[model samples]
Target: MRPMLLATASVAVLTLVALSAPVRAADAPFNRISTFNVVENLPAGADPAKPTAAEIITYTEDGNTLIYSDSPGERIGFIDITDPAAPKAAGVVALDGEPTTTVVIGSKAYVGVNTSVSKDKPSGHLAVVDLATRKVEDKIDLGGQPDSIIKSPDGSYLAIAIENERDEEVNDGALPQLPAGNLTTFEVKDGRVVDASKKVIDLTGLAAIAPEDPEPEYVDINSRNEVVVTLQENNHIVVVDLPTGKILSHFSAGTVDLDKIDTKKDGVIDLSGSMKAVPREPDTVQWIDDNRFVIANEGDWKGGTRGFSIFDKTGKLLFESGTAPEHMAVRLGHYPEKRNKKGIEMEGAEVATFGDDRLIFVASERGSLVFVYRDKGPGAAPEFLQVLPGGVGPEGLMALPKRDLFVTAAETDNRKDGGIGSVVTVYQRQPGATAAYPTLLSVDGPDGLPIWWSALSGFAADAKDAGKLYAVTDSAYAQARILTIDATATPAKITAATVVTRDGEPAKGLDLEGIAVRPEGGFWVASEGNPEKKEKPTQNLLLRVGADGAIAEEIALPEAVAAQAGRFGFEGVAVVGTGADETVWIAVQREWKDDPKGFTKLLAYKPADKSWGVVRYPLDKAAKGWVGLSEVSPYKDGLIVIERDNQIGNDAVIKKLAYVSLKDVKPAPLGSEVTPPVLVKSEVKDLLPLLKATHGYVLDKVESFAIDAAGNAFIVTDNDGVDGTSGETQFMSLGKMN
Candidate 1:
């Protein structure tokens, strides 16, 4: 087989800086240990659909317990992390209003509670909860709703950002609304708040965007009791001395010029776009040291730069990261092309000193990843360490150096949306550690940029090479293409792509789901049919394409079988034999209208005879959703079939591999008087454990599975093209499957 050149003349090739990153391997790096779902902390008879979130998480003083805000549930949930590998629910403390942030001072947890009646009249309080009793001890009435709360390094003072946020729908989310936001500071004595010492520092006339309505989004206190806050919408940053209650300094967070960014949302990731003078509407701000700080330019109504910036204490620009981090996300296939308006959507940041390293973590809310970098002090560019998957919508991040741990609160609770609920993910650090994620990646194309690919629906291993494989993308994109992957590289890489063309042009309106390489040359592709709609309903098609990717033949289902078609048609294809005697097998995704309960079909066709035959395949019963087959690969004894349920996360019951032998097999011709025979299948491996090992909930699609030339089996999950999903792709190899 000839190697396909993935590089194109359109985009510049990008380097994998992460491959040779200057990582501090002397100590073990942080790797996810466990995931704790907030739903487990719900009380008995609680309405599960009432949407709860685990946002703004913080560790207790002892570092053994975690407290996270649950705004929708109107409570703060606790988790015992004494054993970092097995986190336990420590129960939740109910609150009168929505909790936005929490910080542990001694044995009491100070929480920012928002009790606003409406956008016009924002109201909230500072709720002090006793950790031992799991009850609110006191509630200090704050004049407005609170967004961010933090304590001094010495625990002598507490500062909060009274956002009094503007409603987005109100005049298209423009600023300068009434009931302006301000900075509030209070004195703390013996872990108790002094009510009389509470001072409200009016932070108006600071930013050029909306000087009157200064919406303070986040606040962080440095070692000298100095507070640094970010006004995201107004694109401003301010520094205030907590002891004197005096404004120390202020400046606009400013704009950034971004290049090599994918700006178009045209169903493809083309990193040739650029944005000039894009506002760095920062979200979260943190101090790397008393002399410098970092900002996550998440953007709001105005702008988003798709990167991070570092600035000196006096507002001097130190270092700028244009599109480097977000580009690395693209290398890992986490690029959200549909969300190109803001790029990766940088949302949060956290800084902490661990051992000999002062690490800074920048969170991408849309990409579901946290890019870790080592701060090289002031004036020098920080070195990129590695990127970690931050679950789904990792809104809040915290690093616990005292316990050598890192945690993130993923705020997206998709239970109501047929997805997994919110989760608090834990990661542990040990010396000389190796990274685990990004099991698969794409290498730089000829133009230096990584080859862009997503929605990997089907896989086929190279017949001659042990680590070489071919993958097909679904109709997520406009064109149908085949990707060649070299699994020999660390974190297997997609080296090239071939567009499946018809009459020398890219195929249109085709949802190709499966591919099987021909022993002679080229491939046999399968397109899953959708016959539910009346007009332009797709038909399950089997196409034969040559080595050049030009369509040689297109076969459709028989009239009798096509008449009883359902939404799910062909999902996977595998070929046995060669030339004229070559027999092609197709796996139907779900039970068709003609199939019986818990039974789908393994369809067979002969290229020479042009005859169609079918054999029944039994499915495992699902507890909540339907079960179906995803892929079919011929193994030594029989065919290895990927069987899974439509459910996701913990609701999933059947994601396994079932084998069926062809020793006594004879598929009856479809529409014939003879009875169709059922293949006897036995379970070989249960895949639930492998999916759970990633410290994320079980994904719904275990779509592609194949045995390589060395008899090594591999599995990959589809990310739905990162649309309304976390964009976390799992490509795992289970060693050899004999």
Candidate 2:
């Protein structure tokens, strides 16, 4: 047996686990302060339903405003961050073409507008707009499509990557398709471009993979007026001197061998896989100093190393992050199991200095997080700082050290799926402040790997332990398992995991949604089922699970009653009394075919007599979407139930805890045709305020609630296992319920 770790199982997991300890004055951490929805900045007459995104972001010299490119909206959006804690929509500047990237110089914003007629005939221009006037000042044609643009530290030069990007549909997106790309540069004086100084440094015939087509992806400039470019598809890096417009050095980004990673997208987080010599097709590049730079290995084409790497100006490999960041995401429950081929998919990078400390921030496009690290200078190891949660598909990272702030642009909007939309998330660093997010985490198992867990749908407190609880994962993963949680820890640590097994193997086709501890040292769990599922229909079931996690018995609804069940079946399970009076109760999520409009079922089964009964539970009216019961637990003299709407973010409502008295009320027979008596309920707590206090978004599933032996009440939200979600689990204590 492995010793339980109060913090993390391994040193590498400290990136996220370190938040479990107290923070010192010097180690003051960054915590998210606010989120600004991009839709709020849409133009006056534009359709509000149209999707918008904050792809690439930059700030003015005063750091009081943010400018981001909204490619889908074909515009540039602004945000007022004068009060970093409360970001407001300043407005948006409509453009003729899609904006790819934007950079601010003095009081003007320079944007790379892609007006490509076709992949074979790439065309774009640099649009310069006066920030104060909000008018386009000038547009310089570059004769190609621009992907990334940047300004020199000395404010004397601007560099752009003319990426004549290839169409993936064209010959399977193979190289040498057509015209090649080049490095475009211009001299700047007093915030205006010197057009006569325009120089195009051909980047063709350089990469070993495709000498004829070099698709320059990202570019960054250092203080010395030197630009670093990453040819992503070609798997190469190039260094160019701005003043001379000369290509000084270039090198292959190369390949890396990865181990202990999840390689399949089979609805499981198995990290025992390996990849041999995979391409490090890098994306964004940033300079830590004049001597070294870093690249996010996004692996857009064929390979992704699953991390970032550092290189010297001469193309010498300085450091490779390997799988440390991926492991950190796993511990934080941010791992994207559906897109496991590239893991977290590092796609954005930023470097800045705050006070006396230099920091490096890398964005995970798929994981929806930004990884922070302290740069220990060149040739030394960078210390992993902490990870920050973003909205969804965080693509751009910017650090405002002067204001002690960091901002991320999440480009993926999920409103069509009833999820969160694209937004700019802001975080602030304060002295002696601890990390406020990641209220839950998983520790290392006996195998020395962080136990992967998410979609926490049900919870049950220990019979005697004050701070110990048990939780169950739902259909988010293929395998159903019960996890042990130490609520005493600052971020409630998941200490151990036990697979819910049947016949000596992991249980299959189980969506365990609710759990309750039994009086005789076992557990009663409810598995929600959907008969409408065409692939493999499932039936709602009640399982008697021993302490060892093996199923001892399974109970199903009678055929006559089960025939009336809908897709939303059993959601929560609870046990009451003992011996002959032991009654197992299950909460049905929504109205079945035979139920009344606003009423679902609360099933009761007596193990002594093998009899079943049912009572009706009235559901509150939803402001929008549908309202349903998510959980039920024994409380005081009645039951505490979690009722919520299926809406997310600002549209969410009805996430509340309600109590119902079961004193003297008798249930009708399981298959009775008569209307069952309804249970009277009263609102105990409005959980919306607690969910909003997290500063991310109002998650829809407030699925678990339980009270410990010491009278402490806890609530946890299910993240749906990072599938089409931000992968954020909010585990909080409601204190003692009155």
Candidate 3:
């Protein structure tokens, strides 16, 4: 295992400077700008007072247009910016179910539609549309409400994020309602639907260590083929294996107990005989390599202390940067001249690396700055470089070989125009300088507004070629676009890109989450449906895009077997292929239902015939009731799905090593269990309760899960921490399931 790097005196100096800068206003000028707004408002009869559900916004690789959707509108919109200065409304597509999210591959776009418009229904669907034609080519009926959609790097599998809240209400009668969600896997072949499976590994055991309060939030797969998930509310990281969908390990990233903290001192307080720690919110996770990951430790949902924590691929305890890891400076004292109050000191690193001599980058989201550092050794303090300021909200950071550059999506309320988000900023390393600040370049959108608000998520570069860069944004539009950057370009502008629009119409009702590039010039994007609109849910859609910004093809999802009576969707995407051709893998999350035997779905797709297939594995039996599938990625010869068991009163478990063959895959037996061996069991544990009592019962629930390359899985809890009793927070793991 690699050693953790500590902060040095130089870091202290930088921290002081970071604490002195003022917060940038939302309307600050950027190099290049673009924006998109939901052109259409809520329907005439819709509730005007309700907050517009549309949140995420994203772009395609060709960078020509933008795609987004919204829950309140229950529709998807497309904006064509073949001209960055002026963007035109391409078109908007309506769906039978409430559309939540979308992902575009080639010519096909997959959308996660929520059919359960009310708490009584709680189901959804996945809509497959042809981008070139702008028509709903196919629709998969997912039994439960879905969350997010993802594809495997090989192009053989599809993963869905499923929520099964109804099961918890039914099984644990009269108990406090636990948010039920899991990860599902599906099989696809040549744009057709195929086999599907679900794994809901038990997590009842972890309850002893950390309380279950919030449900899972985000899930992903790392290079090592492991699944990692973030339990937002609970502040724990769950790790699982891919093939078997088993819980390999679990660890707490950070713990906080507001009740025990002295409001006057901002520190934990000791009770007569017990110690109380404040709860922290673990928002995001990024893999540095196959065996290492960096976690964004948002101290508390109330916006208290914030920092970053580093962990090995196995979820082991590593090093953590102090509070407020971003590069923004906080005011030291009250200023009489400005009549302003003093601000808290900012410290810690936002993101860090562990390869080729450790390094860390502290990104100040509000300040639009970054602080660089060189790690001396494991647990040894890192040496600070200099304070570098540029684009806004440098949330996502990517380090290229020899040369390191970070991408900033200048996402802010001011950058948004008529609901459309704008451009991405590129900060390149300056040549012949070790401490000089990187040069900033703007990757503009069609309307010249910053193409980012809260939508941008991940960034990837071709391993063989350093000149190519790909970034993804989550949008309400049916499709998520990829921004392809030419690293060789002097100013680093996006030259070309593809979007998730069809027949000049945008795929409405889809929430796109993550994207990955394939070796064959084709890339994949993940779509997650909206849980709030579950009555008429949508199926998970996987799209494939060729090198020239053209849609190559798309795969339609099949109905989930565990979905019994509701709808389903997907969240994350990953692909793994050999030779000239590759197989695509997708993760599916089944919607929550009232049934006790509910399960999630996972599927695979092949590009050869554009047909769909399923993994003939018995994952449902392993989960033993309703299971929520979160994420899936390529591992060994098969793929892995993060199976989160959401059954009430049961501890969540990480299921691993559930393997399936790529050849001769078929669709799942809807509402039936056929294949048996695919169901593999992993470490099971009860999740710690967020509060000792929520009214009368404890709060515990699993939300999202993901795995890294070395089989390390991270689980994110969804404990809101609103209650005072629950103190369990973040968790992680670095060991394999026995």
Candidate 4:
């Protein structure tokens, strides 16, 4: 196979940095333990359709309970994590307004509530709630829309960032349209707030940009009662003494030159793109120690540099992550191509000391991942640890070092779009457990960039190699390509990629979903089609591809058979027999317009005669959504098929492997008026247990399955290219099928 040259010098440098990343062999790895859906705690009788989100999260002082602010529901939610692995719904405290951030002190929870009627009239308050009773005990007027709230390490002071946020629709989201946000602080006596000690410190004229409207976005407190705040829109950082409300130091958050990033939203991840002097408008800041802190350059208004940075109290740049984390996302198939302007959009940061190591976690909102790093003290580069799958759009990161657990609140609830709901995922630091994720990963190509791949819909095992497989990408990406996977690796690695080409150019309008190695040589790939699509309508096609990835032939269905096709078409393809008896099999997802009420067709194409035949396949009765076929592979004297329901998460039910015998059975010719013979099938394995093993919400797309020469079977799921899904691909081995 030839290496695709998609890397520039800058990209190669970034890739090299990732290739040589520090590895701490003795350190324990964090693995996901459980997942909790916020909807499970929804108030009784409340409309379930109303969108709810877990934006900011914090744990109790004892680290046995979790409190998260739900902005859409106008409430604060609590989860009892006494068992860590089995979190329960503790209840919720309803606030009259949107809850921005929450922090717990002793038995009480301090919540920043935004009651703003408009962007210009930013009004909010602090709601102190009794955690045991789940009741609001007190409310103190904050005088503006509050964003981030934190407490000093000694619990003597509380600092709130009064973000009089700007109205983006007014002037292209430019700054300087505010009531001028300030830092509001108060002295803490015992476990209560001293209302008389409320102090509003003016933060104006501190930043070089948008000095008049300084909207502080996030805040963190140090051991010395010093507060560090980030003015996200202004691209500035400020440090203040909590005891005297005096400005300690302040400086611009600054800009960086970025390379090897996908900057265009053009349905492709081209790492050769570059940008100069991109603003690092840091969003979340957390102090790693008294003199240093880390910032997530989320870049809300103008720039999102796609990485994080560490800075000292005097605003000195300690470390810049550059494009390393972004490149990691590409390697793991977590890159969000639609959000190219921000490129993974690093948005959340958390720092804590676990055992002997101070760990810094940086989260990517678009990538649905969290990059872990071991802090190496002040002004030093932190050692990169393994990254974690933080669900979809992870917004809140909280580390409980004492409990050896980490939590992330994913804000995206894509249930309406047939995706999963908002979830709070828990992970534990196991001493010697290998990372359970990235079950499949892509290695760097000869060009130095990772062989970026995702949306795996079908698989074909190598005829000679037991641990080798070939996978196909669906329509999630523009250019269709075939990836080679070495299934023997701990986490199956994609060793190479071959782009399916036509006339020396990457093929277009092809949603390649199935692949099968031809008995003679080359491959036979099935491209799923949708006739209802108004733009560039496609037809289901079976292509004969050469060993070099070039198209040798394009075979379409007969006109009579093609006319009956609907949105769903060929989902999987396989080959059986050799030479004169060679035949290609295709699994049609869902039912065509002419299919019977509870059955779809299994297509048989004879390569020798170029004739088509079909046998009806029975679909399981779905209790909720529609049932469909995902994959079909030839096994023994029969074929194994993956049948599943369209429901995701807790609602999923029918994800299974079934065997259908084909001995002595004949398929009717295409467009036959008589009823086709129904193949008898027996259940092979229930896939629910394997799908739930990773401890994440059950994914809906269980699309690929294949059995190798050694009879080893494997199953893989398509992430929809991280579109609405969590970008988590579960590539697991089902051991031997025979």
Candidate 5:
């Protein structure tokens, strides 16, 4: 089992410990942060099989570890690491069948277990584990397979990801099995689990799935109590209501085509021939405010222009950053080479916000650096900022509020060094912050073989105080776990860390992808699904700890919906508010087949409303099935969904603008008017002349959408073109219906 390497980096030259770091203060630029590598491997008793599978790892508030099952390994690993730097082997646990993922609440941990890896028998079970005792406390046997899990913020209800299968025995005419995904809610009181309500969210009924493509990833929840999900095979994002489980709206975040860029443009580049936009990957989503979010685009296979899309609450298109726009500046050559100060530009910029200001900070993975820009303020033309060196393949970023610190995850290129990884650089802001420049205190990683093989996936911070930082990795072995460090701790030392597996057992799987922090403490982890399974589904796990730094509770998913035929999974998680009465929103990806009536589903859970049950909503229904649905965000009283549409025959397109309201979602008001079609007729000669004089296809792929409190929507298109030649992105007003 070659360990996968995850790396995250940043650049800063100064340090400020106070909450206020001089908003937009200008100062002289300083050198990038220094780098270091802290290597820690699993104990000798850990699995030695060298499994060729990926592992997902996460950390809890009390400092316990939560691990999910991944391919090549079909179990969950739980390790104790009250100490962030040194992790102790706790124990490994597995289900009677293949497990999807796990989530924790209070003192219980919920685990989704799939019984059959093959299509023959797709039944599964939801296993409940006691984190305090480190044992499988109970189990809920369910039909089909359970993909993912979600719990309300108040810990009242639990939602399970379920794929429904057709009643073949009753329909007996040799019809193909109609596989769909749905949500099942379980009530929680006094730490005990009880069944509540169940709703079948049928994706196949919404649209047809592309023949060769897989189902969408999972549905995500936003700040406004909305569910956002994607139609993977098709390129689209679906938005829904969390409280009522209703379908509100859907949109397309444009896709990208790497081949579209014409490096040798003898003439103007034509994107039509090269590539099409696809859906956003379910792995990346960041919350800007209660009503807005930014999504990351994977770009086309050929690697084209990729960036993020912004949207308002109510599923409307706002605006997107320019296509393949240069957001960072870098100095070439080695240090001391004064003449090498020239800068090079990078493509596909992803952004995150620090405060309530219009300036949004961006991280360019391809550029291997970070940049700052005015995302919404007046005359906001993104300006260049200091660049963090090394830390290639940056993905997700977390901002430390009071300490003025920022951390990012680095997904290392595995082909280079057998997939070993390292942490990216971390930087702190100084008091003398300015518009032209800013000071930073930096920390870098080691430069070697085994040290740079790991890749960082998700990030989170301590809610009460931003001084504690936590990050996870997407590695299989190499003790894939969560590392905890003090935000104000100088020299960037790993204070504590925890791995999923223990006792040298390979049954405990840990391929963690996304993570979020709760106000009370602890962390939530999402699994991307096992690569080995043809029907890849995702899962969620909750990890909680106490002030004593002990594993207080591990709440595994309770039983509700069973997995069936289609692929149902989860990606992102967010806690909308504070206090014990808060709500928890989870993202799920529901798959559809070639059937024209396929659709994607998103779900929400309110732990406080234990009896009210879990609510689900439909984002979009396609005549054709969608491929990958990645992320969701809450905006005002609604939600924004980011989806990647992978249609067959045509190039993939990304969907950006879409909305869903939480107030009142009644069966999508019947009798909605359909626009009349237009017809055009012209002579062949005239048509040829018009074609030669026109730009490529007017409609591009859209992947993700975000919304602000004022109802302004922002759409992002994945222009998968290189060298600014082929792909192009557009910014449009949502209300302008042409």
Candidate 6:
């Protein structure tokens, strides 16, 4: 007899095996397994230039098919999830209007289509799509714009949040901006809606503040035929008995006093700010049980408490995780610094019972992260299991307990913005599987708070400690800082941080891209320059800084070569020896005006004598975009460089580790007209496979490369500080490089 995975086996077969015995939840926790890009559904003749998104998602009765709302594409797309690890595109059902949410009942998908001509003239409908036919069979008028839709536990009713959302321009997003919103409901049987049973429930004058404008945001129901709705703009929660269409009880979602949070866009993650009495303008809510529920405080319109809360049936606060999620994000270097006003922006929540455990999943839109916790029950708080990187701006989540699967629908479409587009990421729970994300993180600082950091652009292993390493941030931060990482930790922790200072004040406007420890107790850093900025043209520099962060020296390109330097300057720096005999090598990202076509330079500098020399490095022919060098590091008898294409996502082609032996290599003088010999290169490894292993879009910047003290090679990608990118950083170690 074979004891096995049993993934595709029948339940009866599993029941027969379970009679022998089964393991506990301790074996398999939730972990991401795959990512599906929505662009694969771009229809025939459709402009590939346009964007598409996967907002709210739902699965079929058998959990083999996944349906998601695509607002930009004006359709509902499907995915074949028969094998959760390798999902395939199953086509799309075009809609007449923007899709807000999709819910599957039997073989039919009920999608809320927002047909609003304008905010003041709100209009929409519920389109019932026949999944097999791939067509919309019926449309039920919703009367107003709908945001979220939920079906009763017994499949007896469908509840919709008729959010006639207010225009923010009119009153700075204040409520009572009139044309108040409400709730709509209808009877459902066997997966088809009974149109005649529609009910428009009035939900006004329910909150103490802005009682006239009840902008319903999200809805969910209990097993007892009771529905809970969040009036986001008014900062209130209301429960209605679906059968009677009557408001049972209502109360304010309330405020919270927060501390140890970064409240400004200062480009640094210092947890010393505070928000007092900030209203919890919840966006998504889910019921854990008939008597308990959870709300994600998205802080739309006015308030965002920066966390999620659990409450009882009568609106009593059961648990408040104030600033806790944001703190956890800080610990993982996933905090979006520019979005400090609403740290992490908890926007989606899902609760499901898997095996003997009940799990609550909370998602952060701005942070692109999801926090998973195991519910301990009514009186106690949930236990944190792990944090998952859901694509960019994850707006909704679905938990399939029967299939042991959890899915996230990220609504961001950044193709037009030169970023990763919307994607539906798949995660599965299996015993003995390890959490795959956040390969590295930071520990608490002196204030007993997590060391907040992001936009890591460079990496170098500690010459002594096996798992200890150093990193630097890019221009995304105003103050140039160096962070120390302890990669030995399960999630690799950042033990400390130091701000790079020049003379006295923090180094300003530095686009630091590379760093190498100087063996003599300090470091040499490379700062990429931007010559086009209006303020002042910054020159690429090789800077030597003391162990305490004070600048010791700054070496610029020789005058003649500096005059012809383009925007793509030095990206990486590596030093080969000690003080007097040290030869510093700087890698130019791309060819400058003075260089040969399709070739970049490996410039050399001898600090012992202030001499400059340059050698050419062949560039790979990019299939679709420009290719350039990302990093330079001494490895064994030669130097290893990370060469990559500028394209992201599906357009990415080349991400390679190439090496150049230094045996007979000699750099030509910087301004010499004589052509220098280009180095003969050999492939060390193809980083493309490793980059795609994260189950995300192939990140464009494979910037940092280093071989640790234990001879293990490591690579880190730059997230562009979450600017236009998905804010997903990949830091992994490739064990033992020969």
TM-scores of the candidates are: 0.95, 0.96, 0.41, 0.97, 0.40, 0.95
> Which regions in candidate 2 have their CA more than 4 angstroms from the true location?
1-26
Model 2, 277: alpha-carbon shift in Å?
A: 0.6
Q: In order, what is each prediction's RMSD in angstroms?
A: 5.6, 4.8, 29.4, 4.5, 32.3, 7.8
Once superposed on the true structure, which residue ranges of model 5 sit more than 4 Å away at CA?
1-49, 52-58, 62-72, 75-102, 112-116, 119-125, 140-178, 182-193, 207-214, 256-287, 299-305, 321-738
Task: Write the residue-wise lDDT of candidate 1 on 1-738 in tens digits.
Answer: 111112221211122342223222324567788889899899778898889999999988889999999999999999999998899989888899999999989889999999999987999999989988888989998999999999999989999999999998899988788799999999999888888899999899888888899999999999999999999998888999999998888888877767778988877788888889788898999998897899999998665888888876677767667777777778777888888888889998999999889999999988888888887777457777777775678989999999899999999887877877888999887676678777777877787877788788999999999988898989788778898988777678889988889888998878888888899889999998888867888889999988788899999988888988789889999998777868899999888888888889999999989999999998888898789999998887468889999888778888998899977688899878777798999998999999988887788999998889998888899888876677778888888986
Report lDDT (CA) for all predictions: 0.85, 0.88, 0.44, 0.89, 0.39, 0.85
Rank all candidate structures by their TM-score, best first, as comma-separated numbers.
Answer: 4, 2, 1, 6, 3, 5
- Write down the worst ten-residue block by lDDT for model 1: 1-10
Better of 3 and 5 by lDDT: 3
For candidate 1, the per-residue lDDT at 722 reads 72
Pairwise lDDT winner, candidates 1 and 4: 4
Give the range where candidate 6 is weakest over 10 consecutive residues by summed lDDT: 1-10
What TM-score, to 2 decimals, does candidate 2 have?
0.96
562-614: candidate 6 lDDT, tens digit per residue: 88889898888888877786888889999899778899999888888999988
Which candidate, 4 or 6, has the higher lDDT? 4
TM-score-better candidate, 2 vs 5: 2
For candidate 4, what is the TM-score?
0.97
Clashes of each: 13, 0, 293, 0, 180, 8
What lDDT is reached at residue 688 by model 2?
Answer: 93
lDDT, model 1, position 469: 88
List, residue by residue over 1-738, the lDDT tens digit for candidate 3: 122233344553444344323322111111122222332333456553443333333344355545554544566556565654345657656777666446555566677777875543567777887777778878887765665555544454555655433333454432123444455556556754453443444443342222433244445566545666665445566676666777767665555222211122211111112123433445556555556666665432333234455566555545545432321221100001110111121112333343344556655444344555555444434444544443223343333323233333323222121111222333334434333222212343464322221123333445455455554434422244565545454323344445555445444444554455676666776666544454855544566656544445545554453233244455546676744356566655553352234344455555665554444223444343445554555545555554544432222233332444444344543344554123343324333432211111121333333343344443333322211111112223324432
Off by over 4 Å in 6: 1-27
